[model samples]
Every structure is written in C-alpha cells, then in structure tokens.
Target chain A: MEPIKIKLDKSNELLTDLMPRKFGPQGRLWVGFLLLVIIIGAVAYYRQLKHGLVVTDMRDFTSWGIYISNFVFFVAISLVGSLVSAILKLTNVAWRTPLVRISEIIAVAAITFAAIIIIVDMGRPDRFWHLFVYGRIQSPILWDVIVITTYFVVSCLLLYIPLLPDIAVCRDTAPASPRWKKRFYTFLALNWKGTSKQYAIIHKSINVLAVLVVPLALGIHTVTSWLFATTYRAGWDSSNFGPYFVAGAFQAGCAGVIAVTFVLRNHYNLRKYITNKHFDNLGKLLVLLSLIYLYFNINEYLVPGYKMKTVDGEHLHSLFRGSYAPLFWSVQIFGMILPIIVLLFKKGRKPLPIFIVSILVVVGAWFKRFLIVIPTLLHPFIPIQNVPESWHHYVPTWEEWAITSASLAGALLIITIFVRLFPIISIWETTEEKMNATATQTGDQTQFYGA
Target chain B: MDEEQSNSRRSFIKTGLITGAIAAGGLGIMEVASQDTSKKKGDTVKLLSPDGKIVEVDSSEINPQIPDSLISTHNVREGVPGKKFVMVIDLAKCKNAGRCKSACSKMHYLPETRSYIKINKMQDSDKASPYWMPTPCFHCDNPPCVKVCPVGATFKLTDGIVGIDNDRCIGCRFCMVACPYSARVFNWDTEYQINVVRFKEIKEHAACSTHVTGTVEKCDFCPTKAAKNELPDCVQACPNGVFYFGDENEDVVSNGDETVRLSQLLKDKSGYRFLEDLGTKPRVYYLPPVDRQFPFKDVEPGTT
Candidate 1:
C-alpha cells in the first residue's frame, strides 16, 4: 500500500474570498451571449406552447426533433460524475482528486437540465403529474426516473461530503467576506475539525457511495437507450442499443469535461493546476471512448446495412443516401472517426486542438441523436398514405428551437454560477499535493511555506 | 312474489298472447303484402323453433335481431362474454375499395394524417402476385404497446381490444413507438374547436376530442355504436363485405347482410394473421386476395 499520512493545514481566508466574485469584462460578455441565446429560445418556446407543436417542422412522421437530441446530450454529460468521482475513487486513483469535485458539479448541472428538457418535450406539460400517478413499472421511462433520482442522490452526497473540509478552510480563511456569506460557508463546513475519526468516516462513506454510483450511472443511460430500443422502429430496434448508447454517452461526457477544462485553464490562469498533462490524459481517454463508440456505431448501422432487411432497408437508405445522409455521415466522421484520428497523435492531443475537436465531437454527437430518432420513424413499414402530405414529413417549429436553446443555456448558467462561488479546480487538494511533493523532496520539512 | 318480478311476468304473458293473435291474422295479410313488395321486404311469418318452442316473428325479424346482439358496444368489447373480437378480410374481395378506411377515419374523427386502418400494396417477393391488404389495429393478445406504456395509459382489454385511457396519459408516446404494427397516433394539435351544441349531440356516439395535444389515439372498434346493438358503421358501409367482425367465443360474424360462423369462416376460407411469427396473436384475420371482386383500380386515388 502507498504510505498513509495525515497532516493538518490551516487556511484562514475570509468569506469574500469564497463568495461569488464578479465576472470580468470578457466573462460578462460571454455570459451575456449565452443569456441572449437563451432568451431567444424562450420566446420561441412560448409560441410553440400557445399554437401547439405545429411551430416546429416535426410532423407525425418525425414526432421528435432537436429537443430530444439535446435531452440525450444532457443525460450523457451527466455521467461524468460517476466516472470521475465514484469510479476513480473506488479504483484508488490518486490523480483524480482535483477533478472529482468539478466532475460532480458538471454531473448535477447536466442531469438537472436533462430532467427539465424531457418535460419540455411533452405535449401537455401540465399533465406532468400523470407520469407519477399512472406510472407503470414496466416502462423504461419510469425506470429512468427511478435510477436517475438515485444517481442524483448518490452524486450529491459524494460532492457534498468531499466539500466539508474545503468549506471549513474557506470559512476560516475568508472571514473578511459579508457576514451572511460567512455563515453560509461555516454551516456548509459542518464544523469539520480534521480529526482522524471524522476523516475515517468521511472516507468510508465516500468509498461506499463511489462503489454504488457506477452501476446507477450505467443504469440511467441504459434505460434511456431502452426507451428507443424497446420500440419496433427499424433503426431503434436492436439488442446492441444498450452498449451503443453507453459508449456514445462516455464519449460525449469526456469531450464535455475537456471543453470545460480548457475554458477554465485559460480564464483562471489554472496552468499549474490544469496543466498540459491533464489535457493530454483527457484527450487519450476521449480517443478511447470515441473508438469504442465507433465500434458500436458500426454494429448499430453496418449489420443492418449488410442484410438490408425489408423493414429496415428504407430507414437505412434514408440515413445512408436520403435527406439525413449528410448529417449522418458527418456525425460518423467528425463525432467519432475524426476525433479518434486526431487524438491518437501527440500534437493533436494538445489543449487547443483537443478543445476544437471536443466541440466537434459534442456538436456532431448531438446531431447523431437527432438522426437516430427521426429517420426511422418516417419509414414505418407501411406506405405513407391516407393522411395529409404534411403528415408524411416532420419539421420543428420556432418554439422548439427556443425551448431547446433555453435548456442548454440553463445548463451553462448553472455551471457558471457554481464556478463563481467555488474555484473550478479544488484549491485545498492542490495545496495538499504541493505539500506532499515538498515533504518528499526534504525528508524533515514539516513547516508551512508562503507562496 | 316481488313486485318487479310479477310485473315482468305479466308483461311477458301479455306480449305472448298479442303476438299469437297477430300471428294468426298475419298469414292472410302476408300473402297480399309479399306480392306488393318482394324486392323491398318480403312477407312476415309465424315461426316455431326446431326445439318445438313457438315464437311468432318475420323471417327477416330473426336475422335483423340476430345482428342486434352483436351491435352493442358494451357487449362488443366484452365480446359476447366468452367471445374474442376478431376480423377476417377476404383478399379476394378487396381491390383496395378503401370503404373500411374512410368509415373508420370519419367515425374516429382522426386527424387527416393519422390512420387507424391502412391498405398496404404489397408483393411478398418480386415473383409473387401483388395484392392490396387493409390493416387495422391487430389488438394483439401479447401487445408490445401495453408492455412499454410507462403510465399505464394504453392497455390490453379483456376481450383482446387494446385501449387507451386518455385522461391518464402523460403524452410520452412510448406505446406509439413500441407498437410493431404502427397502429398508434399522437394528437399533435386539437383537430378542431368544439361547439357546445354539436359536442353534446355527438358526445354519446363518438369521441369529443378533449384532445390533450400530445397524447396518443387509435382505433377503438366503434364501442359507442356497438352499445346500441347496431352493426359497426364500417361493416355496414362497405359495398364489398370484405371486413367480417365477430366474437371468437360465439363463433359468428356478419356484415349486416350475411352471417357466418367464425370458426367455419376462418377454417374454410383459409384465414391467417399479420406478422404471426412475432406471436402477437392478433385478433384481426385476413382472407387472401386471390380472386378480387373489385379490380385494383377500385381503390380510386384520394378516396382515402
């Protein structure tokens, strides 16, 4: 086992040091941009609700659109909490300490957005309670509700438990902050005194939660996939769906973390904390995920492509050579293949290039979900007849676009607010690592050193 | 004796005596009536059952009331108590007449795009002869839609008719996706605005769309009409008696003009189901379109 050691370090920062700091000019501008986009989306959604789903291009043939894809994206991004915090902790990977809190915050924000977006997709948003009142245990959607709630609980505990010590550090060190803010931090700190017993209990609880969260994460995405797979539609009906969706989820999640890391590294001058090394490692993980996703993508499409089964053939043709072909091929190449190719090389794995590539993978992945849901529905085994010609096709209206955008903005705003309150990179964990490195360099150096 | 029971017995005897007296005089009147209206309605006659019970009724009266029992929607869905609702479409009689489709669409108040019944133009293989097959909700015994509806909004009825409880639906449309037959439709918008007078008049007979914009809708087998003990509008409307609806329990089905035993019809006509390999156990059956009564052109584009 690695050497076990515990040492006390005091941080006497004031509350102002921990409370929300005002954004700089550039930060304000960035937030303003996201807000403007969100507002536009909101206005669009208002029209949709008033006029009905007719605002969007989506028709009976294409009942779902960009909104469902966005929902899938949020659900995918939420998986990072389990991967970074729970899985890493259970595996005893020490390097993951700095990333655990960041990943958990991202997880909470993404999942919250996921829940919201699903409701937005409803025809009668007011009937939301019907799901609970009449919920069937057999439905995959209900399973999703149950498992996601469980995941949210475990993730919140994991995030909160680790923050107690850090909250104590901020509480004491940041006393110059406003009185109310100070009280808030102090309460959140849970009077952590760094005792051996307290540390042991915290560690044990975290370990237990960590062990439990991975499967719940797997369950959430698997159930989401089952929503489509359980259907008899040509593209969605496949046993390969569970793993295919899981792989795509991890790929999207890893790219999201990369994007967030790059932005934080540049804005906060977190070079020492979120180093090039971190970027390179995350890039390698992204590549592995993209490759795995590619494998599943092949199975999802190519096997069906091979036989061109009578029922499945028309759906496949639409994806391969019809209206959706451009988007389909783009997602395959840019979302999975290109990212995998670029990340394989040393230069391409650098922070800047990986950031560009991550954005592509994420955007491309969103469109991939759109393709997965819509094309198959349009090609029901029977011919499109008897109904109006418009019913034969689907186009989403402006309101759908607005609501979908607002949901995205809402996710980002939560992340922004969280960062304003707490440092994106864990300050306490960084300090501890620095202290350990120093101790190793000088065997008897047990004193604090000013930066 | 209970007052209700004694009153019912009294009325029964009175009706019997009046019927016997009418029968005695009806024979003399029938001879003259038959000559006057042979094409319209033939003579009325007094009849005795094979079991030696005497009951006076017209020849047409026996068959007309025979259809009455099957017409009741409450009884239709309960399916003659022990009977299962089943259909057998004779392909030979179908040249895509589309009478079934139009009757279903108009009766259900379906959105112009949504269809409860579909007429598929199919050829099993390039070498096989082409035929037009009309499809309705199979109302499968083992329905995939029932299995995946998270809200229990869509369910399989006892007599093998799948149904939806619109009030409880969350509009998730999971059932629409789950159905292999593509029988479901989501109400994307309120199809029409309702007027109080019109709504009240139609309310008891057909759906008054309290159309929750996102919930699903599909074929309901004319349950409301069946309650009145009348033939389903579709069965009555079809010029070609292509659709034969009956109870599997009672082993009989009719199209108002013709009645046949359900088992004999299926066995003799070589009826089969759609997608039988999936084991959905569809309540609907099809008769092969080998010698169509109407040519393929009878479908007449835009009629549907």
Candidate 2:
C-alpha cells in the first residue's frame, strides 16, 4: 500500500493481520466437499449430454425446470457485489470496509456460475456459439448474454483494482512464501507504490466504476426478470416484474454476503477486521431489504390475486392452496417474513442468530425462485390435454438435482479458493480507515496526512 | 384427394417393392433386375436436384419424385411465395375423430408419442357445451415464438407463415414458453432410428422434416404441401370436413369437398380467432359449434 505520509507502524500490524493464509483443516474439508459436489454435477451433466433433456423431467408443459430456477438464484446472488462494493461504497458506509472483498468475490463466483448453468439448461449447448453468430436483438436471452458479460467484466475489474495495494503488501511482506506465490502477488500488484497521485487515481477509478456498476447491476437483474415477464404466461405476465425481481435480488444478495461473511469470520479468525458491528449493520440492512422485498412480493402476487382472472386464478390457487402451497407459505414465512421479524430485534442481530437467519433467507430465496418459474408454467392459457398424464406435473429428475447442487457447490468453491489466494478483507482500506478514525479522535497531527 | 393420394402412394410402394426396375429415392433398396440394361444403350435420365442442379443418372436409378423432397430448406423457411395460408376449423362438424392428428403424424414422420396437432376438449364455461378444438401453431402475424427466438431460428416469412429452421435452433426452449398456444414440442430424444430410415428413403430431399434432437418443432402449415397447391395432411384427412385450408390472398378455403369465400364464411358463421384479446392476430379462425352434425361425444369416436 503506499504508506503515504500517514502511519507506517500500524500498516505493518494490519498487513500481518489481513494477509492471505493457507487453509485450516475445516477450510480444507469445505473445499474438498465443494469439489466433490462439483464432480458429481459434472458426471450428471455428462449423462444429460449423452441422453437428451429427456433425462430431466422437463417436457413440453414445464419446459424449464430446476436448472432455470438455479440460474435465477445465481443471478440473484451475483447482485451482492454491486450492493456491497458499489452501492455501499458510494454511500460511504463506515462499517463496509472489510465486507467489500467478500461480497465482490461472491458476485464474481455466482455470476460465473449463472452463465454456466444457463448453458447447462440449453437443449443444444454444443451450438452455444449460434447465440452470438445468429443472435437476434429482440430476444431477452441475447439481452441477458450481453449485459451479463458486461457485468462480469465490471465485477472482475472492481474486485481486481481494489486488490492491487493488498497484493503489493503481500509481495513485500510475505517472505516465507513459495517462489510462484510471491511472483503471483508481485505480478498482480501492478507496480503499485501507493503514491499520493496513484491514490487519487485509484479513488477516481473506483468512484467511476462504482457509479457505472449500480445501473448495470439493476439492468442485469431486470433483464433476467424479462426472460419471464416478456412472455404471456399467467404468473409471469406482470409489468411490475422488473422492480420486483431487482428488489428480491437485493435481498438475496444481502443474505448471501452475510452468510459468507459469517463463515469467513469464524474460519479465518477475522474478528479484529470484521467485528460484530459489521454483522449487526448487515443484519439491519437485511431487515430493511427483506421488508422492501416483501412489499414487491405483495405487489407481484396480491395485485394478481385481487383480479383473479380465470387463467391467473389457476396459477394462484396452485401456489396458495393447491400443490405448491406448502412451499409457497414456507418460503414466505421462513425466508422473508421470519428473517424480517427476527432481525428487527436487538438480540436476534447477533452474529450466530443472524447467520442462521441469513442461511434461511438464502435457502428461501432459492426455492422462492423455484416458485416463481415452475407454478406459472404448469398453468398456461390452454389446458393440458392429449398428452401423457405424467405431463400434468413436473418433478425434477435426480440428474437435475445433481447438476444444480453442483453449481451451488462450484460457487462456494470459487470463494474458498479465492480466500487462499488473497485476503478476504482489504488490508489497505481497513488501515486507512483505522488511521483516519485515530486522527479524528486523538487529534494526532503527526500521523495525519497533509499535516 | 387424401384417399386418392394414399392409394397412389400404396400402389407406388407396392409396385416398387415387387418389380425389379423399381427405385426408392437414391438411397433406398433398389435391386433392379431388368433384362435390358440401360447402361448398354447409354440411356440417362436428367433430373433436377432439390437445390436446382440438373444432374444425369442411369435410367434405372431415377427416384420417384415426392414433392416433399423437392422443397429445399431455403424454400421451407421462405414459405409458399404468393400465399398467405389460413385455416378455419368448423367446430360444428368436429366429432374428435382424430384423423387430423394421425395424418399430421404420418406425413411428418412423427413418433407415436407426439404430434403437432392436439385435440383439446374445451368447454367455454360451466353452462356452455363442450367441443373438440384441434390446436396447431397459429402462425400469428405478431408471433410470440418468432420474437423470443434468440438465434432467429424461428421467423415469420413474408407469406404470413411462421417456420422453424432446426439447423439454426440452439434448443433454448424460450419460444416454447413464449407461445401461449403451447403448440411447439421439443425433440428431447429424437426418433433417430426412424429418422435414419426416412432420411435415407428421402435422400433426394433437403432432410427438411427430419426431426433433430434438442430442437423445437411445430405445425409448419405444411409449406412443402403448399408448394404443390395441395392441402395440409390434417385438412385433407378430416372425414367430416372439419378443417378448411385456403390462401387468404385468394379469398378461398376448402375442406377437400367444399370450397368457400373466406370473408363470406367468417361473416356467415361468425368465425372468430381464439383468445383474440392477446393481440397475436392468429391466422387460424374457429366457427362456433352451432347446429352440430353430431352430439358432443366425450368417448373415443369409433368406440360407440
């Protein structure tokens, strides 16, 4: 980090505390577990490629199955990077220093898998190049492809640019490391000398990217919602879907960041950097997000429930009282309603309770996506007729479950490997914030910059 | 017209199966054992290929010309150049005989499990009487399926027909969800064994109707049949004259037995498109089931 005119002694301590480290036993087990799930998903995908989509239970009626829902989940979770690194950064949230890198990595991993799982859902993934070669601008799928690629590039840059100072710290301070790792950190450090001018440039670039990323993030998720909303299907035909999906995405992403932050804090002993105050702030943020998501949920469902058009009634009935009632009620109660209720109280905002609630939110968000995609498909304008009786219901085959679970595991694995490769919390940013706080509190003109 | 064509087809295949000089396309079992050899006499027959190249082959090797094979993929997607094809299903005459479904599967070489046409037993309300609705791809002017296709695999041609190019389709299934009619079906696992045989026997064609695994298929309005001024198989095979196929441009539609003016028929019978509020502007229209020929029987047609 360029130590500048500020304190260098505190930098040494923060650098030692925030540098990347090897995985402990639990971390190794977590990585191994994630790899195992990913391997099984690959094998299941092989079977799918060998047979056809027939291997899955998706037929003409429910053309999209769990793979699509999983895709939506990934897209939803990927929005956290924008929420933490961009939106929170722009607002100058005081406690957001340590949480930014974790959420950004989660966004990178989830968006990468979002792109992969969509290809997996394709009937002819081998012809994926045709999407680019013969792509029509009218289709939402092409829109998703373009925006998602843009978002991925922007997220990677957001993740990388902030890491240059930290990587330079690692390169200079990590003397016992292997040659390649030292070289790796050195190369990635981008010759950062932490000069006053370079700091200005970095701050300027971060600000520009931060502003650029928010709308792009909103557009990415809104375009994803359009993949369904643009169609004429009953549950999917709402004009309110764009904001509804974006709000729901923000909720999921917030919970995703909280859940990962809890694990990383406990596993890496990063309490000095992360602290309970960060979790408390995130818990309050999740509560706010969940309520906003609930507002959109009411708009999405209640307005249609009020009208109860003949076609939409069937879809609502299935969700409210029929086959899907159990899931619908459970996801609402446990995922959204319960988290909001629990996080509103002070004691519930503690690290452990909030972590459990965030897990529930993440799980609920996944099935909430399932509820969004599948119910509408089962109730089309035309009656299901002249087909086999089995087509009346959709149940994903084992291969579908395997592949979907693998995608989830694959995302976790990305975060896990990233932790080993670089610090999960930013070293330079945390040091700068700590020094600024000390300068303000103690009137320490000696350590203050431009003194 | 359908019976005549079926008989001619039966005799053609029967004759080819027995006689020594018979041919079954270019790749079929053609064990010609004629006493006079056309090669010795230097006899050659000039035939135009599907792509419009005139090639000369031995007289013995000339394939029986099926008009289906002659329409190239480019022709299939381009549609019948001059005609805006439309259909009117007379709900009054339909007894759910299911001849349309069978004929559609037969002509398209579809597997037994699936067909482009579905006979939906629909009742408008609790009080209204039920009728059989044979739904096909409506080929709407503002086709939802065409608009959602990411690769432009499905497109609305100038002739007002929506056609799908399986070769171009990436099998994303977005069009299937986009279509409110539920008309399209995926080739989840193709009838490849049967398609191999059909592809061989129809080798002289562009492999147009051969089903591809992981692609979407629907009622193409039989553009290949339209190329020859013949009705779609479903229209010609309906015994009760339940379906009327016509060119809207010509203002005429026929159900094999009777021909009528399009405007007059719709005006007189109060023919209407299904789900008219959706703004799809479907090409197919339906006449309300009034003055029915037979009672709305829920049982299978032949059982009673």
Candidate 3:
C-alpha cells in the first residue's frame, strides 16, 4: 500500500485517460454506417446463396474472383496481431503497449471475416461441415484451416490475459457502467486483485501465448500462400510464395495498425497516449516490412520474367503489359514502393500523413491479393478455348462487390465495437511504462515499484 | 391326379396374367407367345431370386430390368476394375468438324455452353502448322486435381479413370484450378443449364454422375460406355476416325472401324502425350499432325 500511495496519482491519471468511454454522436454515426454496410452485405450474401455463385460473374476461366481476394486480404491483415503483439512483445519493444490491443482486435475481426468470406466463395457452403468431417490432411487448404484456427485461439488468449487487469479496473473505477457491462467485466476479470500471484500468472501465460503465436501466425499465412503455390499455375508456381505472403502480410498488417491507431487517437482524444513517437517507430517498422516484401516480390516475379517459359510468359505478359498490367504496377508502386519512399522521411511519419499512406498500403494490399489469385487462373497452361470471350476476362458483379464490401465493414464493426467496450490501449501496462520512464529520468531509485 | 394338376397350373397362370396386366397395363406379343398353351413349347430358363433359390421360367417370360447394382453409388467410384483405359487422338485426321464436341456434350447432357470435350485449334508457333486438337480429361497418373481436392471427392481409380463423385464435392473449385489442362468446369447454375428430366436421366447413368448445383463437372472419359466394351461417344462420333479408345493393359485400341495394337500405333506414328515435361502422365496421347489428312490451309487457325 505504501508503494501504491507513491504511484497512485500517476496511475489514476493513466486510468482516467485510457479507460473505455461512451461513444459520442460521431462514434454512433460511424457504428451505424458500419452496421448498414454489414446489413447490405448480408443481403447480398443471401442472394448469392439463393441463386448460387452464378449471381457473381465467376465463370470457368475466371473461376476465382474478388471473394478470394477479400479472403486473402482478411488473412493478410489479421497477421498484424502476431506481428505487433507477439513478435514485438517478445522482442521487448516497450512502445508496443498502446498498439497491441488494437492489433489483436483487428486480428480477431479480420480472421473471423476471413473464415466467413472463404465460406462465401464455396460452391456448397451448406456442406462446409464436410471440410471437417471429410477433410484430407494432404491438402494445403486443410493446413490453412488448422493453422488459422490455432492462430485465432492463441491471439484471443494473448488479447484476453492482459485485458483481465483492465476489466477489473473498469469494474472498480466505472460504477455507472451498465449492469450487464459490470457483470461482463466481473466475470472476465477472473477476480483479478492486481496481487503479486495474479500478475505472475498473467505474465507467464502471456509469454507462453506470445511465443506460441509466432509460428502459428507464420503457418497460417504460409499455408494460405501454399494454397496458390502448390498449384501448377504460372503466377502461383513460385517457391518464394510462403515468405512472400508472410512479408506482404507484415507490411499490410503494420499499415492496418497505423490507420487504426490514428483513428483511435483522434476519436478518443488519445493523442497524448499514442504520440508522434509511436507513429515514427511504426513508420520505420512499415518501411522494413515493405522492403522485405519488395525483395520477395522481386524473387516472386523476376525469375519467371527472365525465364519466360511459354506458360509463365503468358501469365507474366498479362501481369506486366497485358490486361492486368495497370493493377499489377499500381499495387507494386502504391502498396509497396511508394509507402517505402514516403515513410522513409520523418515528416511522412506524422499521424495524418502516415494515416493516408496506410490507407494506400491497405487498399493496395487488397488489390495485390486480387492480382495474385485472378491472373494466374486466367493464364492456365493451355490456351483459352471455345468458351465465351467474356470468360477470358473477369469483372466482379454487383453481388461480389456488395459481399466483399460487407466483409470489410464487418471487420471494421468488430474493431469499432471492441474499441467501444475495451480500452484501445492497455491501461495497466502503459502506466507501468510511464512509471519506469519517470523513475529513469528523475534518477530517483526510491520511486521504483513492482507489481 | 393328372387332371387336378393341370387345373391347378391353369389357375396359377390365370392369377399371374391378372397381376401382370395390373402391373404392365397389357401383355406384349412376346408374353402372349410365351403363354401360348396351344403350342407345347418347352424352352425354360433358370434364374436365381433374392432368396437364393433357382426357379425355372420360360425364356420369353424373362424381361430383364437393369441391375440395381449398376446404378448404385459404390459402383460409380469403384470404376471398371482390371482395365486400364486410354485414348489416342490423331491430330492429322481432325478437321474440327465439332461432331466430337457435340457428341460428348449430348451424351453427357451438357448444355450448349459446356462440353466434356473441346476441339482446340492449336498451333505451336507462327511457323508451325495449325491442327484441331480434341481434348478431354487426361486422367493423369499423378493428377494435380486429385492431390489438391480437400475432401477426396474427385479421385483417381485403379482403372486409370479419374472420376468425380458430385455428391461428395463441396464445390471449392480447388480441383478446377489444379487441373493444368483446364478440363474442369463448375456447375455454376446447373439448374438452369440442365432441366429436371435430363437430370434424372443423368442420375441413372453410373459413369456420368449427375452434377450437383454448386459442384464441379468434367469429362469422365465415358466410363459407362467403356464398361460395356463400347467406344466412348467422342471416339465413336468422330467422322474421320480421329479418336482411338482401348485398354492399355490389352495394348490394343479401336477407332470404331479399325483395330490396331496401341504399342505398334504409337511406335509407327511417334505418338506423345501433351505437356510430357509436366510429368502428369496423361492417359490421352496425340500423334503429331504430320502426314496431314486435312491441310492446315483449310481451317482458319483460331476460328473454332
């Protein structure tokens, strides 16, 4: 209690600043918009279900369309949880405290939609249970299913264990919260008193999950990449797909975190908590990830471009100077190259500019996934035959657009609701970081405290 | 005693006639012929029933129904055992008449837009001569489609026929993507493509398993015809005798009219499988369009 009194004033300030707050009119409007988008998407999905996939423009040649691209986007974005939370946490990056919770929320939401969008792409979603009942171990798709589920569980544990103390804080500090919210906090807090034993268990559990999540995260995206790479198609036949996907996922994920943190900072008035330094550090991280992904992109495309094997030539020709060239170059330039160029500057790392760049990175990543799945399918080894000329090209139907938009909105809804219910930043950990920072600067050994 | 036995036999015949009339509306001429009491005909055939007892009946009385076992789901996946099926397409003979495509589509009840076989007009390069290439499922020995099928719905049978069980297919289209030949097509809106009457007709055929609405469909190499030692529809329907069907195990193939040794034909013609470098081990072979039966000048290179 003596040490508590010493740190009480600073800790209370953190609690007041970082605690979850009621949404204002603007927040309510945002939630309403997300809900409306989700409803529209659900209605589109219903039509797709009623009329089969024909409602979409997916034919034989362009069999896989934007739904698959959307699935890849969700999976790629979800990897942010593992990158920011598990990887940074293990590396002892102290600045990650405020970003970890947001990353985890994005991960959970994106992954949940990823699973949904894949089902949406299926010809027989009613038989989705067959994936489990009759799933074969040999298929890369089964491997993706297994690892994604594992990653989801590990990410949830990682998000939840650290949240126990915060939930307890909400329970004790906000008595005016709804009775259901109080009951929820009380149940989830697991009676956390912030005692030495509770803190020890929480720390140990988080460390284990953080360690476990790294391989699982890598496995999920790598398996997803293998879904394309394991096939004999031109664009997807590269051996570099696994690492290429993982690297691109990291880039997309970091961009996602930047965008989300920017929104949270402005909306919740959390500018002091998520300061410029976090953006600067994140900007640097984004550049490193983008550079790595750019390297992989070279490995993925350059060899095939050089070899120019007949089938690979057709696929590369399409991607380079054919129908898909515009998209391919745009994704490369905007998603990878431009982000690297812009974020290298200090001024570009500011919140507003970084947010704008992040949007580009994220949108480009979505189209990048589209380019990955569709172009390879169009340029099969054999020439396109007597099928309809339209089959040779793909244009997503209104149903496809609606459904894909819905999934994105669904992910945003999850993140928005999570921000409403829980502290977007980890309160207890941020306070600890503050206390340590204060002690170091003042050179006062007596002010140091341990949980 | 003889009179009593004859009277009882007559009564049995009368009861059978009444029941048969109820079941089949009216007896055919054959039934009347077999039941002719005026002629003392004594041609009897013995048949076994479900009870495992052999009963004697007149040969004309035996109107056979197709065995229930033939249409069972298990037989569809098992395929014709002890036979390794293969096909050889002579590119020189093909003029892209499109009869093979129509024959295949009609037999499989495929819609006008879809076909189990496609006559691709192929030319290796600007210098190379154009030829009509009728392509079907290769039924590859190391099938990429089978390897990637997550549910084991589409599988390679021991008889060298790659078959798809539409009931088991989840319609993920992974198999469609995995097929390098572009042989697979999804039943995107099968209900509209194939009507209800034709759907039931397809179900009765063991080889051409009726496609589900959201599942995959492809050329199954006409396993139903092959099981009966008959040529596949495409092989039989080709006007120029382009397609040759055979059992690789027997080493002989026939083009409806002409029979030749598979090994000898390949040796003489220098036949090769498509995309041999891919190592798919396709069952469909091609004889180079050398010594052309139809000149490359006749058909435009990219038209049909």
- The prediction achieving the highest lDDT against the true structure is 2
Per-residue lDDT tens digits for candidate 3, residues B14-104, read: 5766577534322332343254443444678788743569989876454322222233222556656568999999998998887787887
lDDT of 1 by residue, A133-153 (tens): 877898888898898888878
Error of 2 at B32 (Å): 26
Question: TM-score of the candidate numbered 3?
Answer: 0.88
Residue B252, model 1: lDDT of 73
Instruction: TM-score for candidate 1, please give it.
Output: 0.84
Candidate 3 wrong stretches, greater than 4 Å: A1-11, A438-451, B1-68, B71-74, B192-204, B297-304
How would you order the candidates by TM-score, starting with the best? Answer: 2, 3, 1
Which 10-residue window of candidate 3 chain A scores lowest in summed lDDT? A1-10
Q: Write the per-residue lDDT of candidate 2 for residues B1-304, one digit (tens) a residue.
A: 5335544754665576567556555333232212122234456888775456998887645322333322432244555556788999999999999888888887777765568988889999999999888898899999999999999999998668898888788989999999999999998874442555546555333434677888888998877666567888899999999999998887889999999888889999999999999999999999999999989888654211
- lDDT (Cα, 0-100) at A100 in candidate 3: 92
lDDT, candidates in the order shown: 0.72, 0.84, 0.83
Q: After superposition, how far is residue B278 of candidate 2 from its true place, in Å?
A: 0.5
Fnat, model 1, is 0.63
| Number of clashes found in candidate 2 | 1
Fnat for model 2?
0.83
Query: Candidate 2, chain A: TM-score?
Result: 0.95
lDDT, candidate 3, A1-451, per-residue tens: 1121113344476767777788899989998998888898889889988889999989988889999888988999999999988999889987788899999999999999999999999999999998899899999889988998888888888888989888887777656647887888888888878876777788789888988999998999999999998888888887899999999999999999999999888888887777888899999999999999999999888988999988899989989999989999999999989999999999999989889999999999999999999988888877887877778888999889989998999899888888888888887777666666676786532222221
